[model samples]
Target chain A: MLNIKDLHVKLEEEDKVILKGVDLDVPAGAVHAIMGPNGSGKSTLSYVLSGRDGYEVTAGAATLDGADLLVLDPEERASAGLFLAFQYPVEIPGVGNMTFLRTALNAQKKARGEDEVSAGDFLKLIREKAKSLKIDADMLKRPVNVGFSGGEKKRNEILQMAMLEPKMCILDETDSGLDVDAMRLVSEGVNALRDAGRSFLVITHYQRLLDHIKPDVVHIMANGRIVKTGGPELALEVENNGYADILEEVA
Target chain B: MGLPADKSDATADRLAALTMPDGASWARIAREAASTRFQAMGLPGRRDEYWRFTQPDTLNAIQPPEAALYPPEDPPAFSALDRLSVVFRDGIFDPEASDDLALEGLEIERLSTATQADFHWAKDLYGVLETRGQDPVERPFAALNTAFATDGVVLRATKKILKPIHFRYLHEKTDSDAILHFVVRVEEGAELTLLEGGPAAARFNKCMEIDVADRGSFHHIRAQGRDHERRAVTHLFARLGEESTFKSFTLTANGRLTRNEAVIELTGDNATAHIAGAAVGDGDFHHDDTVFVTHDAVNCESRQVFKKVLKNGAVGAFQGKILVKEGAQKTDGYQISQSLLLDEDAQFLAKPELEIYADDVICSHGSTTGAIDEEALFYLRSRGVSASEAQDLLVLAFLAEAIEEIESEEIADDILTRLESWLVRHRG
Candidate 1:
């Protein structure tokens, strides 16, 4: 469902290369985990795929279901079924969480030429979805991510993902600041959205999160490229040993 | 010392175009005193400290600058509320269009009729607060309005008012120069809400004096008219008694020049006051908010919050000060003024000051001018909101703090709706 081939990106303001050459493919219904060390361009990859500014695509292409994701604006990419759960969700003061969600949902619907959801239906739907993530009425009423705990921010992201129901999801370090309980809650929320037509590319530094939401495939990314691809045991190997061993072996 | 020759000449020329209306002996005395005060101060010159940021040439002109009437397609602001509507057409009191000037727990009278009476309660306050506010800083325009204004309303609340009083001004004449004065008194333990709206005239000068007695409360919400060519200068002077509450909020959109000045004095202990405004200006729009709050009693609190959204060469200015007197211990004062410049050409000038003679008071002030938060903007757009819609949301969020100062949720919502429309119309 998602494809990237020889994606080379550099900082737009400077001539520093971030992703030299990267290639990845996550088929429909597959959960792919990308494990990488710090400064290995994992977050940069996620940002580039989501159409963030300050990044210049020097070479190659990325697509979703054969649609050129590189050419579309961020919102258009979203309407094209691309969702990126930010590593750190923005704290937007004065914008209620519920209102943000509703505006986003309606905006995507309008962009896709679909009828907008009624307010009542939206409230009901959000309540049901948010309950599964343990988000209460007060959290929904408050400003988006303002004063939210790290775990709540992550869960809010998952709630957004579930509401958007994108065809492809990219979770960039979702387990970074979460506790064990919060990690489990967030993993469960993500697992609930797994279906035949959906795909996920989970980017992380640790293997513990994979225990909650099992991945179909694992890729060890290093030096701006995915050098190794294997089964879940690859993650176990890295967890027990380390990326040092893999890097040395690959070299 | 005498005034500068040019300043005196300008003030004289402006006053030459106005003929003071005849009134009772007391009213006549008050008008003459105000005129004397105004002449001494003279029209604010460009070199004046307070007028440096905004030019007063048009405001001091003899003839009112002509402004084409912009009859709003939408219904007037606060029209949905159950209110006692008082209408004015081009500065004249339109008795036929206004409701009966009577309500329970309240006494309301037209300024024209009130001044005509030989003995009236308004005579005590018509220009009393304006004269008091002139000290330390001169407000010559307010003095002029007090001296020559022949149209407005006098309101007194004896108890909690169930409905708000709405003053709706309509601009139907291109060169109409309207001067209006309002006097409000809230008795002890009484509560009242005052609502004002409209583009009164091509050039409008307005003055309002409010006295809130001990334990009384007064809420004011005003929406300046949407005439893009209109020029206006307004003054609001208020005195708060012991344990009283005073809150005022203004929402301004689309005017060529608007200067709103408010001076509040907390005289009795434990009183609270809040003043807030949100202005949106696009192209040739210049809006200024000048506020001064003084704390003279112990344990008083005051807050000022102003936000402006300027685009397409619009200019916004804010000058606010908080003064805590020597014996006003434990005073809590906070002030914040911010502007969102949508483009490179939009300008925001702010001056925030705090003068404290009491060492124990806690006063904080801040001013900021910036473009939209790019991170927040991208965050919204990444969630599928279009660029324009996302910017509008951020603009509303930026003004939300000022809008929150409105006590009524319904009114706050109405203000939000108006802001949204303004953003949509001015979207890039």
Candidate 2:
């Protein structure tokens, strides 16, 4: 359901290329985990897909189900069913968490030509969804991630994803700052949303996270390109031997 | 070089023609004293330090501009709260429109209605506090207000007041010049709240002198209405007794030119005071806030918070100062002035000053002028909110810091709602 062919990206301010000749495809109803070392253009791919500023796509094409994603604005991209769970969630002070969520959910709904969710309905749904994720009423009431723990921020991202329910979800280093318990809670939150229609692209360095949310296909990414595509066993190889052996063999 | 300039003297001639408050008592003497003071000071000039950032010509106009009275878009700011309403139309008291001039635990009398015996206590107060504010700096307009103002209220609180004294200044006539003075005295252990709102006139010069006795509390909140063509200059002078509490907050919307000044002195040990302002201007608008606060007694605290939002070439200025006197040890003073310019054309100018003589005091002041935070804007937009919606949220957040200084949550919420509507209307 997601496609990137010969995708090339670079920083807009400086002449630095981050992505070069990268090609990847994730089929519907499957989970794909990409393992790579530092500077593999993994985070760049996520930012470019989500339409962040300060990045320019130089060549090639990236699309979702035949729709060109490059031309749409970030909000439009979100409405068109693309979600990026940022590695570091932004802190918006003075904007209440509940108010932010309702505003965002209704905005996306209006963009999709659907009925706006009433405040009462939003509160009930958020409460139910947050309960399973271990989010309390106080956390939901505070300003959006203003003084939240790393785990709380991750849980909030998952809450937003569940609320928006986008078809294509990309988790960029969601496991970076999470502890074992927090990781378990986050993985469970993501796993509960897994279905035959929704696809996932999980970009992480460690295979430990893969144990909790198992990926159907594993890809080794290096030098801004997918060097090899394998099954779950590839994650084991990288976890046990580290990417040193694979880098040498590819070189 | 400028051909023996006498432009400033012309305003002095205009003030000479206006009638002064009449009486054979101390009130009249106060007016005569203020008249002499104003005649010497004339009007503030561009070269003067106080009027540096703001234009002084409009305030010195020989005649009030022939402005059409703005049709108000919102009702009086404090209408939702319970209050004793006093109405002024064209700067004249409207008995028919106002409630009966009676409130428990408080004595209210019109300035014009006071007779020889009735003016006994008020005569001592009419311009007493105003003269005290002129030391270290001169406010020619406030002295002018004191010298000529013939209409206002003499209010005194003897005990805890049950309801706020609300003054609704209604503008009905165009090109009207209004000079108003209000004198308030809160006695020992008493409490009082005073609320003022609306555009009083096309050209308005107003001053209020307040005295809070030992252990008394006084609260003042004002909403300067949206009248882009109106020119107004106002001042508030206050003195606090030992252990007294004083707080004042103001909200200003659109106006052609507005200069609001407050001079406060905390004399009583352990007294606390806070003065805050939140103003929003868009298109041909100019608003100024000049505040000076003094701590004269030990262990007293004071705060000054001012925020402004300007857009579409609107201009805003803030000049605030906090002073701690010698031997006023353990004093706490905090002051901040900030402006959120919506675009490049809008501008904000600020001068924040702190004069502290006390060796053991905590005094801090800050000033900032900036556009909206792009990262925060993007964060909101990335969640699917429209650009305009995201900006509105950030603007409200910027103003919320100053609005929080208001003591009453209900009134604060009301003001917030008004700001939201203002933002929506100004969004292009």
Candidate 3:
């Protein structure tokens, strides 16, 4: 459902290259994970795909279901069913979490020319989703992630993913700051949203997250390129021996 | 051979040209004293310390651009509240449109109808609070308002009133110039809530003096209307007794020039006062808020929260101070003024000062002016909210801090609706 070909990106303000000749493809209904050591351009790829500013796409083409994703604004891309779960969720003070969700939902509806959900229906829907994520009413009543713990913030992101129901989901280091319990709850939430028509690109440094939400394929990235691609066992291999053998094999 | 340069005071020349209203009421002596005080002080000059950030030209002009009273479209603010309404058209009290002047345990009398034989509760209050508020600095317009204002209301609350008193000022004359003065007294253990709304005239000068006795409570909410060519200069003087509570919130939409100054004195121990303003401005809009609070009694608390949103070269200014006397121990005072500039041309100037002479007191003040948070903006936009929608959300969030100071939820909601509609109109 998502495709990229020879994507080259560099920092806009500085003469620094982040991604050099990277290419990947995630087919419909498939789950893929990208694992690499530090500074391997995994998060950079996610940000460039999400149309974040401060990045110059030197050479590349990215399309979602054959529709040009780079041409659309971030919000337009969101309406076109591209979702990126941020690694560090922003803290917005004085904006209630529920209000934010409602505004977002109605905004998307207006863009899609669909009937907006009533307040009562929205309350019920949010409550149902929040209960599954173990979020209480107080969390929804407070400002969006203002003082939320790291785990709470991650869980909130998963809750947003559940509510948006995008066709393709990109999770950037969702397991970075999570503990064992939080990781399991988050993986369970992701697993609950698994469907035959949906796809996920899980980017992480550890193999523990893949244990819960098992990926159909695993790719090893190093020096701005996906150097190795294999079945799920590649993740366990990297987890066991690290990226030493993989880098040497690619070399 | 050089010609002599003109040395006449520009400030005095501006005030001398305007004629004072004719009055021979019981406040004649107070009026004369204030007239003399104004003559000495004259109009505020551009070089004045308090008027440094904001120019005093538009406010000092003898003839304001005649603003044709725009047709009223929206319902008056606080219409849903159960209130006793008093209407004013072009600064003149309209007896027919107003409600029956009656309230339980409260006395309401018009200054025009008050008789000399039966001097209302305002006899001592005509200019007493204004005179007391004048200290190191002079407010000549407030003195001028005292000297010439002929139409207003005197309110006295003996007990807890069931409903609030609403004063709706309507503009119907293009060249209307109004000077309004209002006095209110809340007795011991009594409660009062006052609400004022409207764009009164092209050039409006208003003063409200409030005195709350021990253990009394007073809540005020004002909504300054949108009139692009209108210029207004207003003053609020309040004194709180022991254990009293006072909170005032103002919502300013838009105007050519507006300067709202507030002076509050905490006279008795354990009294609390809060003053807040939330303003929105577009092109050709200039809004200023100046507040001074004095903690004269021990264990008193005062807070000032002001927020402004300026766009398209609009200007906003704030000058606020908190002073704690030597014996006012354990005083807790907090003040914060913030502004959101939508673009590079918009300007916000703030001066926050704290003067504490007490050995043990907690007084803190802060001021900030900045654009909307980029990270927060992107966060919302990434969630499918449009760019303008995200901006509106952030603007509202920025204003929520000051809007929360309103004591009534319903009134706050009404103001929020008005702000939303205003944003929609300006987005065009």
Candidate 4:
């Protein structure tokens, strides 16, 4: 469902190459996890895939179900079923969470020539989803990410992804600030969204979340390239032994 | 170094004398009082304390006589909605288009012929809460307005009256200067919401005096004209009663030279007041909003927020002062003034002052002036929102803090729509 062949990305206004000759593919109904040490292009890959500005795709191509993803803007990529769980969601004051979510959903629907959701139905759906995510009713009334705790913001990101129901979701360090309970709750929300037609590219450094979601494959990335691919057991090995040994072997 | 001083002085004298109201028993007294104040203050100069932050030269050059007092050539038809409408043409009251507005325990009428009983309450309270003597500057126009002020509106809500009141002050262009004075009194335990619009053509000077009796409440919203050529100064002075609440909002979208002076005095214990204003100026428009709040009783609270958007030689100023008098303990006051300067030629000045003679009071003031954040711009652009659209959203958000306080839903929505359109036009 998602493909990136020999992707090479460079930082804008500089010759520094952050991602070099990386290849990755996730088939339908599959979950993929990428583990890497700091400075190993973990976030750069996500930024490049998400089509964020300031990251130039120096070479290669990225596609979602045979359609070019690199050519689309972030919102277009979002409407095309591509979701990126930001490491730090931006705080947008005065833009209520419910309003922002409804706008995004309606924009996506409008792009696809679908009927717009009524306010009543939208409120109902959001309430149900937010409840399952352990989100308070008042949280949706506040500005997006404004005054939200670190863990609450992460959970809200997943809640948005659940509401969006994207075809391919890239989770980048979503577990960094979650407590034990919040991590389990967030993992459960992500797990409930898993199905035969969805794909996930979970990026993380800890094995704790993987134990809950259980990815189908794990890839080791270093120096902007994926040098190792194995089943879910590789996550445990990397977690116990750390990424230094893997980095040496990959180099 | 500039235009000859005598030429301007002679011009002002001609204009003031030329614009005096027509013959009436009260006209002489009004003119005498007005000329006395005008003579004492002359035209506000740069050296004046209150005129320090404001451009007094432009005001000095203005000497408009009473503008044309005629009906609108083609007045916009009012919709079928059951609203109490009062229309003014060129600063003259028009009874043909106004509603009688007979609500229980409330009276809305033109000030010209109101009986002694009708104005007895206002006459007892008018100018009782004065800021001129407190500030060392002689406000030439305010004094002039007071001296010549006549025949506007007297809206009084009796005790415990809850009905809303709508006031529309429409200003049309005339060849002369126009001035209006409004008096409002909300009696004890009475509540009133006032929606006022200075939708006028250039050449109108408006002043409003309001007082809230013990336990009375008042909410006033005013939108100034949207013409850079029009020159205006609107003074709003309000006094709050015990346990009473007062809130006022002033919006300045366009004007050549406009000033809105709002004063709220919490004279009763546990009284609260909030004063907020927003202005977006373009061309050589100059807009200033000066707010003053005094807490005289214990446990009173006051808040002031002001925002301005300037572009292309436009100038904006915000000078807010909060005072806590002696024995007014436990006073809580917060003030903030911010501006977004869109062009180098555009200038903004924000001055926030606090004077607290009482101990154990919480008061703080903040001011910020800067362009939009580039990082946030990049983020919005990355999301596919065009630069102009993103800016419009941000600017609206910046101004929303003040606009949101408006109590009237219909009027607030109308103002918001107008503001949105203004933002779109100026986004470039």
Candidate 5:
């Protein structure tokens, strides 16, 4: 569902290369996990794929469902079935959570030439989704992420992912701020959305999250390139021994 | 001290073009007093401390600069509400378009006719609050409005009023210059809501003086008209009694120049006053809000909130002050002024002040001018919102605090709808 070919990205404001000759592919219905140390270009990969500003894709290409994603605007990419669950959800002071969700859903629908959802139907759907995520009505009514706890923010992100139902989902460090209970809840939410037509690229540092989501494959990333690709046991291998041995062997 | 030569000359030139309307002996006396005060202070100049951020040239000129009239496209504001409509066309009362001048729990009349009576309730408040507001700082334009206003409404509420009174000013002539003064008295235990909208003229000057008796309440919501070339200067002076409450909110969009000044005095213990405004401006637009609140009695509270959205080199300015007099213990005052600049060329200038003579008081003021948050923008766009739609949402969010000051949800929604349309129309 998602493909990257020799992806090279550099910071726009300075002369520094963050992602150098990185390539990865996640087929439909499969979950792939990428484990890397800090500053290893894990988050940069997600940002570049999502078409965020301040980054120049110098040399390679990324595509979702066989459509070029690099040339699309961030919103256009969203309409083309790409979603990124941010590591840190932004706190918008006055935009209500429900309103934001509805606007985003309708915008994507309009861009894709689909019928816009009515307010009543949208409300019903959101209430049902929020119930499973344990997000009460008050949280939905409040300003987006304002004064929300870390768990609540992650849950909110999952709620959005569920609502949008994109084809290729990028979870960039979604487990960074979660406790054990929060991680369980978030993983449950993600696991429930797994289907044959959807794909996920789970980016994390630890194997704890992989235990709940059960990735189909694991790739150990080092210095912006995938140094190793293995099964679920690779996550446990890194957990027990750490990245030092893997880095030495790869070198 | 004698007025400066240039100031006196400018004031005289402007006054020479206006003729005060005839009225009763008391009204004449009040106008004469105001005229004397105006001559002493003269028209504000750039050298004045309060006018430093905003140029007073067009506002002080002898002949108003001609403005091209904008075609009215949207329905008039507050049209959905059941109200007592008072319509004015180019400063003159349009009796044909206005409803009957009668309502329960209130006495209302035209200022031109009301002041002609030898004895009237409006006599006590015609220029009383404006004159009292002149001390410590001079507002010569308000004095000028009192001396030479053409026409307006006079209202006195003796009981709780269920329906609001709507003042709809329609601009039809390009060179029409208008000056209007309104006097309001809310008696003890009474309440009233006043709604105003539309572009009055090419150049407009308005003054409203309100005196709220003990336990009385007054609410004001005004939308300055969407005339791209219009110029207006307005003043609101209010005095509150014990346990009285006063709240006023304004929405301004699309004007060449506008200066809205509010002076409020909490004269009795436990009184509360709040003044707020939201303004949106595009190219060639300049909006200013100057506010002053004085706490004279113990435990009085006052709040001032103002927000502006400017783009395409538009300019916005705010000058707000809160003063707690000696013996006014436990005074609580809060003031905040903020502006969102959409482009590098747009500018926001603010001055916030607090003066406390009483030691036991909580007073705080803040002012900020910033651009849109890029991270927030990216977040919204990544979720499928277009760049323009995301910006409009953020702009509305920035102005939400001031819009929330309106007590009525229905009215606030109306203002929000108007703001949304303004954003869509002004989209780059």
Candidate 6:
């Protein structure tokens, strides 16, 4: 479960409030979609929740499964079963994807006092997951995101989430640049990982991704605040009518 | 400066007058002429071009006298075993510490025994590849080495031996300057690998010449001296034959003041040469690598890559030049020098040059100096890798590009392990 209470975050040394008194909660086994226009602070909410720097949490609280997510560092949050699928995946040259994934997986395992996975087991798991995603074997050998197409990078983020098997995941605009075929692949990957014990917070500007994901709850966020909550039909309305209609209802 | 001035030299002269090694005749003449050159040029002053980036005061302050060939006052940490290892203590050969190599078709012996067989292979090639028209600022030190560097190894690969030859130099607390000259010839179609490393914790100067006959290949890896108070200057001049290849990898992980000069000439068509250097400095250490690759024949390919990581107010220097002569058409040359400064006070200076007279050639050079990427660090951190660990991995990746050129997997692994250890120590 994930919960945020009156989350207020401001950029360092600036009075501009990126996340203004936002509140949301996602119970286990539920899929939540947060939709808003540009600059509505959807990405900032994810980064602030993930504990990225340059943003000050002036006031508010964020908790995952009753544990303080805001107080933990980025790595600690990752170990605590929080995963953020970045909108723009970083290109890390000379760092092989397999090596980076193994490091992260084992680091979380170590943090949890669990036994580390054997190299053979790790390789097998990644190979199986990568096969299902239609990722070439060479992609695992190359540097992380280096030379990878935009769709490939987004798919890689999903592959990582699958490999990590985190309890809570926040995907930030993962379908922004994906073609219909790539989006189907991404949605299939996300669907494959769905379970009753995990929660996913999908953030996007378009309703196309929601058509495939079919969130259990939809929250319309406007001006850094969630104005309304509705069922899956809400996304279709926003898709057809846009944010002005939602903002007028909230006002 | 007052006690027993030149007593060891006087004694050496008296001994040379009586029971000098038969092969010492040419060495004697060579030594006298080198000494004269040193006296005429004197030690390099700050005004000299080559010495402009480096100061000679540290070396000039060392009043090294000719060492008396004596057994060690204490046991050395390293020993020569079944594998052939040439030992140099204080730049003087320790006959007791060396083993006679018995590989077939290969001739490995001390320079004092300079034989006709040795000259038949490499006599005509020695001293022909010196830095052209460049003044030797430390001429005195080089002259001293030329005069007294009596017994060094003269290795000849007779039948393309693949086994690596190891040269070990060990020095002690004494103030001594060593001049060592090495001549190696890989016969036509032969192959050889040489590993030269030493803990020469004193002022030392070295000159080595190698000739790779037509179709012969040579791989040379040199790990330089390490002493906070010592200075080291080393020169390597090599010529590659037609269709032959010469590759040199130098690792400078520890040193106070160190300079390495590499000059490689591809004299025959279809020759290939590569020079790679990686150095790390965590203290006030200073490391410099200057390499020149000349393409005199057609269809020659040459590459040079240098990487340095400097911290704690250290300095790193790299100067690389690739030259393609008029007729050396179809020459493909590439050079790159990159440095990572880990500390605010660390500094790096890199210069890359390409001189091509042939219009049909491909030549390019690049140099970059920067700190570690902060965004990359954040990404690694977000992935659960600690900051220091991330830095270490990035630095290793930076240097691995050069070290990966080594043909032998074992040697590459060994160098990587050593680099990891050095990073661990510095990070601690």
Q: In model 5, where do residues sit more than 4 Å from their true spots? A: none
lDDT for each residue of candidate 6 in A139-231, tens digit (9 for 90 to 100): 999988999999999999999999999999899999989999999999999999899999999999999999899899999888888888999
**Which stretches in model 2 have alpha-carbon errors above 4 Å?**
A244-251, B1-8, B115-118
Return the number of clashes found in candidate 5.
0
Residues B237-300 of candidate 1: C-alpha lDDT, one tens digit per residue: 9999999999999999988999999999999999999999999999999999999999999999
**Each candidate's TM vs. the true structure?**
0.98, 0.94, 0.96, 0.88, 0.99, 0.89
lDDT of each: 0.93, 0.88, 0.89, 0.76, 0.94, 0.78
What digit string (tens of lDDT, one per residue) describes model 5 on residues A190-250?
9999999999999999999999999999999889888899999999999999999999999
Lowest summed lDDT window (length 10), candidate 6 chain B: B73-82
Winner on lDDT (2 vs 5)? 5
Model 2's lDDT to the true fold? 0.88
Ranking by DockQ: 5, 1, 3, 2, 6, 4
Model 4: how far residue B347 lies from native, Å: 4.5
Which 10 successive residues of model 4 chain A have the least lDDT summed? A103-112
- Model 3, range B244-265, lDDT digits (tens) per residue? 9999999998888899999999
lDDT of 1: 0.93
Tell me how far the alpha carbon of residue A107 in candidate 4 is from the true structure, in angstroms, after superposition.
1.6
Q: For residues B111-192, what per-residue lDDT tens digits would candidate 4 score against the true structure?
A: 6654234325555544334433225334566666655655577778886555455556666555535677777888888887
How well does candidate 5 reproduce the true complex, by DockQ? 0.92
Candidate 3 per-residue lDDT over residues A88-207, each given as its tens digit:
999999899999999998888888888999999999999999999999999999999989999999999999988888888999999989999999999999999988889999999999
Worst 10 residues of 1 chain A by lDDT: A15-24
Best-performing candidate as measured by TM-score: 5
Better of 4 and 6 by TM-score: 6
Over A41-77, each residue of candidate 4 has an lDDT whose tens digit, in order, gives: 9888888877777888989999999999999877677
